[model samples]
Target: MKKGLLLIYLVLCQVYVYAQEDAWVYLTDKDNTGFSISNPPQFLTQQAIDRKNSQGIAIDNRDLPVNETYISQLKNQAGITVMAKSKWFNAVHVRGIQEDIDALATLEFVDYIDFANSSLNRSASNSNRQDKFEIEESLIDFEYGGTQNQVEMINLDNLHLSDYTGNEIIIAVLDAGFPNVNTMSSFQRLRNNNDLLGGYDFVDRTDNVYEFAGSNHGTKVLSVMAGFVQDQYVGTAPDASYYLFRTEDVGSENPVEESYWVEAAERADSLGVHIINSSLGYTVYDNPNYSYTPSQMNGQVAFISKGATIASEKGILVVNSAGNSGNNSWQIVGAPADASKVFSIGGVDASGAYSSFSSQGSATQSTLKPDVVARASSTFVIDQFDVIVNNNGTSFSSPIMAGAMACLKQALPSVSNEQLKQFTRMSASQYTTPDFMMGYGIPDMQMALNLALSVQEETFGELKIFPNPVKNELHIQLPSDTDTTLMIYDVLGKLVLKKSFNSTYQKINTSSMISGMYILRIESSSGSKTFKLIKS
Candidate 1:
């Protein structure tokens, strides 16, 4: 009789373990009267509030933190595992069995229960093979192959020449995982300078992102933005600060990953990230019912796309990759990329032609999808082994464009995110007639900077400055005779020279200034204009 009871007990234990699965328990409300949006500092970083203030974004209920009372009540429940929480949707994501889920539904605060993945299966990234595309040697401009050319192709180096290397800007990279970034020699500078602001593994519910076992795809992705190895390799925004987030589950494609993504994005916003670069996307899932139809790529249909749009509405610039399905039957971009607010990126070749494998856009809504394109085929990046190599996909293209955008943001901090988007689209090669393949072609960063400068110069028109790399003298040309106060400050923001003059043309002796970058602030009765002057 005792032996029979032991057997029964073992059977019950097996059933208990097998019964548990992943499900989401949606809470109706926070139900906390203590929290308020007026007290933003209690939840959001000052930098986050500053970004919203600068962009004219108002603080709302969505900015409020999740109710701790609801969380405490859910935590006390048995057989329920809370995975993540989202303030935007006012929901809690949990993993539990059918019986426990049913019990939770009976609670007064429980709104409903939704299954994230009823079937225990992994949703893998489809067609994500790391195939090395062939490259013609003749098309290569530098020893670095398409990596250096990609920067020059878009005139991104011009921004670098102006010393805008993404300094002071924070970018959050949301992907699968970063394995070697913590130990890679190529990332030594980032590690030594303390630019790698640390990371979190949402999938495992751990803070040890570096020690976890994950795909190297995220390592390569981040290298395209922050990797630097002197003349051997230079990323687009090598000096930018970064926060690494592992949201993708390399083994699975499920609605849970979407929730994880939204949670990560919300965290990034609260931490004051200026930009988010996400190479992950969602379309098909293991469960047919959860898979999204191509018609659903209208941006509003996908949960991830909606979350991405909300992130943008909160004044964060989201950059996502257009999926790689050009040759497949899907032949279209994925969610979040379909969201108009996202800076969706597609792939191109060194020859400025759209890659045959790059995804096409224009949602079922018939709106242009990918905002721009960058070199993807034969795109160069550092591998896990610390070797410089080429890879293919819209994944590389997205970060390439994202890094350059960060550099541009550093250069023009006063330019609002929306204005920057408009200037960027206008700076594209095919802005006049953009199609699905390459929304607005590759953007020219120099052109965008010039356009921004022109707008800044509108208040004081027809002003020409010459001898940019000046050693002794600098000349200014005015459209008409006007009284002006010219103040020149060094890169350190120290005033070097101050002069008041009234003339159509004036020559200022710059011999006394040191050889470096100087800010020329020209203030007149009409307005003030500032120019970046290089002294050689």
Candidate 2:
């Protein structure tokens, strides 16, 4: 009889363990009755406030912290364990049995409860979740060594020569783990200059981001931008400051990881981070019921994607990997990468070809994704063990582009994040003809800088160009009534049309031109002006 009771008890224990689940308890209001947007310093740092003010981004309720009173009340509830909280979404992630999680909805402050396991929820929504080191020939001034090809492929070398090496820019790296970043020899420069700011481990709920026992993916990713060894290996943006964040739990895949990411992003925003390089992407979860469908890659659907969009709206440039599902059956870019505001980076080979493993964009989405490609195939990085090695995946490509963008940001401090994205896309090799595999293709940083400068130095009087995506006739309005020379060039830099116009308003016949992107340059006595034209 004792043995029978023991068996029954063991069975009950197993059931209880299996019954435990994760969920998000959303609060109805923040209860910030006395908070004011004008006084942003209460919650935001001075640097963060300055960044918003410079960008003309107004401070709003989203900047307000979640109500601590509501959180404390939820903590007092039995069987409810608060895991993570997000101010942006006004939600708190918790773990408990189905009944315990559901009971939270009865509270006055509780808005609703969204379970990680969709089957357990009453709502309709479902949520979810390297190689060797070597040294090569140096071509530019910086001793890039093995990383020369990856940097030069995107033309970031030119920016380095001009001393736009991401000085004063703070970047937040959200990934799995960053082991040995403090002890690595390549990161000594960052330590000496205090560019390795600080970090937090959202997964472990601790301040030590480098002590996680998970995979060292974050460490490798950081080396692509922050690693610097004299004449051996130079990262893309060696002078940039960084805040390492561990958000991913390598042991298990769950929606709570997404909550962890949102929390880290909020922290980065409060600390005034300029760029966020997230080499992580989410689609499937350990619980199949919490898995996301490809149709949900619409950017607005996923929780993490929404947080990323908010980060972008907060004046932070969010760069994410396009994912490595290209060769798999589920061949599409993952969420957060699918977010329209994110600069989703794809991977390409050294020969300027798209990497087969780099995830592609879906055809159903109206917006073009995998915004740009970078040299991620066999990309070089510094390992946690302090060895120079080559690795593959869009994971490395995102940082390559992020570091280049930091350099561009340093060069054009006044340029907004949206304009910087546009300039980079316009500078891509395949901007005229983007596809699912290589949307806008690889960016040329030198060309991007030139485009930005051209727009900034438009000293010529206001010129109006209408019907930009012209199907037949193209209209051009000159600033002054003077003889203006108009020239149009194809993506290959070949002059296609050249004509002289005397009238203030001129109409050019473009009915016979092919459908693609063209550069229209107008030269006159006032000044020369350039415009990008699309012929539909």
Candidate 3:
């Protein structure tokens, strides 16, 4: 009887020794590549190349795909199963026993192995994994119906009236399952117009993104940008094209989802997507050992946040939800939202008040977080069942802001993503007095449009505008002698100051002007020039 008990105990020990753990295998190089940066068509689409060219971004080695031979070698290893691969990071996400994973480090192509369990890896850190899809109660004009308040609060309706409704722009939605979006009545217009492009389920490694059994958080998030019902409801960017990507696995909280998200982001970049809306944030995880500490909230620490910053550097306008942990002990924005380059969005109510549940910015980071706020309280969204319902969370607010950004992109195709973010911040209600909760506060889409338009008309050569964000005085210097008429208009298009000068320099008193963005236009016989002026 004692011998039999010993045998059983040995069998249990073997099982425990072989338990699978998630990890990322970093490859040393992409040595065997047939693609060249000069011939970008070999890997990048024409649209993507054009976008990079327009933004003055060069195609580099980072854009190259990972070595498939390396991936195959890792897969052939004993007990190792490759899950997701990222070309941007030159790494592959895998699952295997610790012994098996560690053996991969001996391969010639393998750079190192990062275990998902932070305790196992010395240089690696984990993310805080929260339920980003949690329902919160929370649009745009043109019979916006339940969405009128949300839309008008951000002044997106004015842009809609001006015909800047996101035409010819593409936005990718990265989230959980989007069940029923392919068959729902609320998405009928998108289907009929062929605005619903293709999508992929990275979590399931499938092409069908609308058939998953996970949470329907993606369905409602997309509705805020693409759903439409005549005379009843209209999404913020109803005319924008879309690409759905399911990167999150709602069934469990794991670091592999971050790899999946980066993989999806790479696909979006390859597909020439102009904007990416990720209504998700990571904070705490199911495994306590993989949970991130508050200090890791710095934009560069988390893997997902690093990927988000790379996506932005690639010229994609990456928008993320700030998180819904404001009322909880974890009262700070999560990964990707904390990423410096990402345009993080926060939540607010109908009265333009901060939502109690909107995540706050970290006191450690120098950059302002929750870059701007939008209506998230009792915001209306179309569920998987085609029913209009009120939901709450930054998930809804992020999409709302994303749709507005699409319209702005359509209106100012020449503006870079960084400039777009700056213009949006300058147009916010609290640009001069931003806070942790609201950041720059609610954005005025019309004002942002005006700011972009004014900057686009800068034609005067050698013209210099100084002391911008000026306190009490503004200075201007011209190239040559010419009778120039100067006029300053508020963001509302209301004339605030007018003067005519022929000298090479001019100064204007701006002490009495309210702190905000204004357009300074100068006209002469040569041509008209416009400058974006800020009074602080």
Candidate of highest TM-score: 3
| Model 1 lDDT tens row, 152-245 | 9889999999999999899999988888889999999998889999888889878877754547778888999999987778899999999999
Error of 2 at 277 (Å): 0.5
Report the candidate with higher lDDT, 1 versus 3: 3
Once superposed on the true structure, which residue ranges of model 2 sit more than 4 Å away at CA? Answer: 1-18, 32-34, 124-144, 456-502, 507-536
Say which candidate scores most in lDDT: 3
What TM-score against the true fold does each predicted structure earn? Answer: 0.77, 0.87, 0.89
Q: How many backbone clashes does candidate 3 have?
A: 15
For candidate 3, write residues 43-152 as lDDT tens digits. Answer: 89988888888898888888999988888888899999999999989999999888899899899999988887866776523345455665543223323466898899
Query: What overall lDDT goes with each candidate model?
Result: 0.80, 0.86, 0.86
- Between candidates 1 and 2, the one scoring higher on lDDT is 2
Whole-model alpha-carbon lDDT for candidate 3:
0.86
Q: Which ten residues in a row have the lowest lDDT in candidate 1?
A: 130-139
Could you give me the TM-score of model 1 versus the true structure? Answer: 0.77
Residue range 232-294, candidate 2, lDDT tens digits: 888899999999999988888778889999999999999999999999888887566677788
Q: What is the lDDT for 317 in model 1? A: 92
